[model samples]
Target: MSHMPTNIPDQSQIWNGPAGRAWVEAQSVLDDMFSGIAEYLTAQTRALGARQVLDVGCGAGATTMQIANVTERCVGVDVSEPLITLAQQRAVLADSPARFILDDAQVHDFENGAYDLIVSRFGVMFFNDPVAAFENLRRATRPGGALRLVVWRSATENAFLTTAERAVEHMLPDLSRRKDGAVGPFAFAEPGAISRMLERACWSRVRFEPVDFTASFVLEALELYMTRLGAVGLVYAELEPRLQAALVECLRQAYAPYTIDGRIRFTAACWVICADAEA
Candidate 1:
């Protein structure tokens, strides 16, 4: 494996460790959970002439394979070796044209002006310095190249996320102040802040659209679901076994209301953003 540059040590450790392995194991489940919005994002690309495509934060090669079906050349890059390994395996098994690499998009030296379109699903929010990270991304794109991404809007707006977070925080004391600019799923929740970063990166024609969809999580039981989650599982791992059991019960109860026809369903909201490199 080639050296992958990462500016965030904590994030690098987390993703390359348990979090990445968890995603690889739960890849299919995650695909089912997020495929609705992911497919929606891809559907919007019919009008674009994307011969070469880049899928940033592409986990397990699902989105990369999807893009490869349409584009001449496609590549997916991620910081997680396990996920990248799974992605590469899937690509090889499926005889896909998409290429997978383990690298950080924030600092990787992508060939300049190589990609016609760049897309991400719930990616691009983990950068230690978002503006600088995006500036690097801008330099990777050709003039007038388009970039599209789907990012969680906010914790308040996404019940699927907030429910679990609320339940966890309610059971356990607030661990930290959740320092601003910390890399997490909700790092780019604020649309205005993300827009300013894009502007600073010198991207033009930037736009954000709210996308709402019913996200489904298939689990035989809430206990199974609880164990499969990476971050939450890590949090639960710290507690005594008895406390962990209590936490699971609380999460199950909190999730009960969202179960529809025996499937866990929640209203998920995200910002579908698009922009063009300076022409």
Candidate 2:
């Protein structure tokens, strides 16, 4: 049996439940959405000449397969069973050397000093005890190994993520109870906080680089995509049919200013962080 992450039970519950299923259903779309970051991380892995690679929170195995293409050994680990299953299925279909494990990375017993490169794209956040989780990850990495992570910079800066919520906020229940800077998508938005956490975890040479890009989606698919996942999606579904229709129209009108040539485009603000295991 895999080692369960006691410190991240809530996170595990979220990922292994509806969130996990939703990701599995939209694997292709999500993969395409994050392709650019995946490509960049893969290139960094190749450039570093990493022989053994571990992809943290490797959802759907997209980045793991990409790294496997260039590295000798690659393993992808996640807490989401559905996502891991989909990733394994994808690996088999593609004949890729990547392997997927359904386990909590925060506590999983990864081979000590086994990986020379650890990477995550829009992962590595959501750890209830981030310092402890990163320390565990550091123990799995070889001395002098590289760690690369791509995370959202800030919710305020990423219009693509918040526009829909803003559009339909009036109809939804008050979400002020939601926690921030603790465990969630934007947990590590502040560079200083994340840097301190990594340093305390025994990682060295930390650096952060801003990566701003535009995300484009087909106008016709925008509603379905936005109404299918995330916090907004969850509450949006509970709304009555009449309100739901109104919300969809509200979203459409709110996004109208961002549409260009039949495609809805918005900015995605993120940070690509790099660090090294203490040698």
TM-score of candidate 2 to 2 decimals: 0.92
lDDT of each: 0.77, 0.82
What is the TM-score of each predicted model, taking all chains together? 0.91, 0.92
lDDT value for candidate 2?
Answer: 0.82
Candidate 1, superposed: residue stretches over 4 Å from native: 1-9, 174-182
Say which candidate scores most in TM-score: 2
Worst lDDT 10-window in candidate 2:
173-182
Q: Lowest-lDDT window of 10 residues in candidate 1? A: 174-183
How do the residues 1-279 of candidate 2 rate in per-residue lDDT, one tens digit apiece? Answer: 332235444878888887787778767667766777788888998799999999999989999999999999999999889899999999999999999889988889888999999899877987767777888899999998989998888877876677777767677757332233646677778899889989988899999999885566666667767777667665666778998898888888887888899876666788889999978
User: For model 2, which pairs clash?
Assistant: none
Query: What number of clashing residue pairs does each candidate have, in the order they appear?
Result: 0, 0
Residue 36 in model 2: shift from native, Å? 0.6
Residues 131-250 of candidate 1: C-alpha lDDT, one tens digit per residue: 777877888899988998988877667656656656777567753323234467777777777788799888988899888877887756456557556346656656798988888888
